[model samples]
Target: MSQTVNALEVKASPASNQTGYRSFELGSFAFSRDEYFAKVTWHVGGQKLSHVMSADAFLRAMMRDVAWGFFYGWVNFDPVIGTRNLYGKVELYAGAYHPAYKEKGLDLTETFDSREIMATFKAILDDWTNEGFDPFAAPDETDTTWVGKKNGNNRLAIERQRQACKRMPGLAGDAELRTDKNGYPVNRAFADVSQEEPEVHAEPGFEDEVHAFSLFAYLSRSDVTWNPSVSSVLERSLCCPTTEEYILPIKHGNDRVEWFIQLSDQIEWEIEDKQTGAPRAKVIMKAGDVAAMPADIRHQGYSKKRSMLLVWENATPGLPELYESGKLKPNPVEF
Candidate 1:
């Protein structure tokens, strides 16, 4: 007896409190409110296939998947589909098996048109909204299904591209270099030289302290290459295996102040009052947390993971510049 397979389906409804007609609508073929930014996997013929989501979420997820190696297509939104202003923009990135043309024996400057793929995606959207078909509906269970058939065709195109890459001599090397962490090796040659480090010492009375913060930035460029080495330079201010941290101290007439920003998991902090020697109020931060320290409040870093922090000081620009330049000594702080 053949086993019965439950087909997936998508259901759409008007957003709550929304009425009348608007220029555009925002809805997902397979996404639910509860699963916002969540991965939606599509399967056909018992084989897992493509996934899609918001562009920002997609970029981050894809980076996590390949450790930050992939190309993307420009987002083209259609007003006829269920997206409002700014909602039509969707980012399309390379799938894991997508061919890296430069990896094969292709010239770096060679270009391939992605017009057909874009058209197919647009057609899919048009069919969904026009036919009132559920976007979540499974394409088909067998190889003869629409999605399976298209995927099979796409796979062939991908394979042909892969072959082209293999035929090129320098192409494979270039592709490998593109995926390399250190970056592609420039062909420029030069004589080798050695360098020595200068001696450095910390003051006898100085104490080390840890601070934490978060980094939020947008990918201004399409080719976003995250270089761990470049990120290492920020270690002095932000320290984490995956993040960074820093410490800053302030002094006033006969008094001192410190502030800290701990960017990490959710937790509570406890400190001892210096003057009263009493338990201070507990500070709590949940996972995916960010907090700012008060100018008068002294804070300590505490997080399960290393955190990246950005510090904004109120000191004189000249003084801070001197400190950063290693001319002025950093005030000591005891944990």
Candidate 2:
């Protein structure tokens, strides 16, 4: 068989909307936040097919399908919830469909090149990137430990963990040190966690008075996506956690409830239904702002600049079951 026989071409149709709608060969999908629901319309071969969906659900599905096609040469939507309301998942799995039903979304499924589909997917992402619309992302910039290159306007120096927690196996120990690219300590103040005990700062003349705590020291060294704990408040409550910029692509609601206290800068959060990935709200939080993450939904964050975020967690082991059993509401406060 000749490879040329399995070629595919894709481009955005003229119906594509700049902010709300994205057009594809088979259909167009709407991405509006204010709207309660999203819609996908199929305009192929004079046949019209359409599906209405929750906005969050659509975004999650769209992002996944596009990513799969672009990066893997095929698009699969099986993992998305609330999908039974839409067209069947576009896939060619073993014994999934009859020969006649093989081509539903793609015009020529048997002969279509995943690479060609990938190219089309890239086109869509490139357009979104240029327009400053990033909803799906998790780059290499995220670091739980303060270890990465500190670029312009970044001013902070901190120590790394000294050793793995005696309790948790496979966790990082204090080994990373403040060093130049050539592996030398950038300053005398820079030391490894293994080299020193936690400290507070004060001048020699003010030995008895403390100026600041070691938490600040750790903040100075973190990269864009850092999120780590520094304080244990109780059997289940936690504090002294911070998040770096460059948000993760997926939402996290695996836990029952999470807390956020804006330490510095601002972030735009996209909240969605956890099970269905349906859009619920968009929250803008700045320094001193606090928000509670409920168990019923997932949340994603967007930071325009390098910022510091303080997060608190409820580590109680049974919190999830309580929320699921309806004994506890997703919201912590009662109206």
Candidate 3:
């Protein structure tokens, strides 16, 4: 059974009231829309596979999977299909075992009816080839902007700024500001490093009193556990947090370096070679420890207690090309 089947069976139209709903009308197949999900029945190689999944999830997954396929030369559909349970195993039997099954990755032929899916993914590849998008970037940034801020395309690709976490205090040096019990601004709140005035003195220059500021205070303030919240953004790089009991998902195979600072507690990370899926390293980061992840790896983290994790990312636009072209070393500080 040739895996070349047209699986997108366009059937129905969704109501107009649903917000942010889009039907796939790209390539030879159009979407068969429903109220909340997409019902696509693709006919490939004289076989039919019907899959119904949430519209938003499907689109996000498809785009991410296709993008991964472009960069890594393969994509895993089993994680998507197995977790989502949209299409049954029997429906995908014909396309499951393919010669192009490059790695232990999922079979992409299991989704599409024809080879046109390749073309769609290729379109995504074209962007990364030049004006590339960073899929592993935070939700606030995903698409690579080809033009300046004035471009409408750039506006469309923008993400909503996160509001939940703590913002950075514009202090050039540590202990520069002082605070009272009520977090009120004052001149002399604490002693400085000089230790002449008192045990804790204000950092030089002009000191200002702050109401209250502490890492323990910040970690205590967060009630939600396990989910990452953005804490601060320093230019294009910033730290987001995860108050974790378990671990975070390895979203996309990142093609660039990302730094991790264990602000408090510990996290055990299992890093694997991105392309080959081989174990590269196992690391344990304790409090105040920092680790830099290289581009050629995929990693996941586990924490025993509800711990604080500071995820630092480099949002430099041209970094991907720099690393891919061997212009920059994967390790920022070369030993």
lDDT of 2 by residue, 98-148 (tens): 232224541222223445544444443333222222233223332221111
Q: What is the C-alpha lDDT profile of model 1 across 1-335, one tens digit per residue?
A: 11111221223333323221011111212322111222333333355433345432322222222221111111111100111011123323222112332133221111222332223232223222212111211112112222211111122211111101121112223212121143322111101111122233536543121211112210011022111111112223322122221211110110122233433333344443322213455566554454443222223334332223322223232432354455544444434
Q: Give stretches of model 1 more than 4 Å off.
A: 1-264, 287-292, 295-297, 317-335
Off by over 4 Å in 3: 1-100, 103-161, 164-212, 223-227
lDDT of 2: 0.43
Model 3, C-alpha of 26: deviation from truth (Å): 9.6
C-alpha root-mean-square deviation, each candidate: 24.1, 14.4, 14.3
> Candidate 1 vs candidate 2: which has greater TM-score?
2
Cα-based TM-score, every candidate: 0.20, 0.43, 0.47
lDDT of 3 by residue, 223-333 (tens): 333344455667776566645445443323455788788877788988766554567889899989999888766666777765677777665667766777889877778
Ranking by TM-score: 3, 2, 1
- Candidate 1 residue 91 Cα shift, in angstroms, is 55
lDDT of 1 at 181: 41
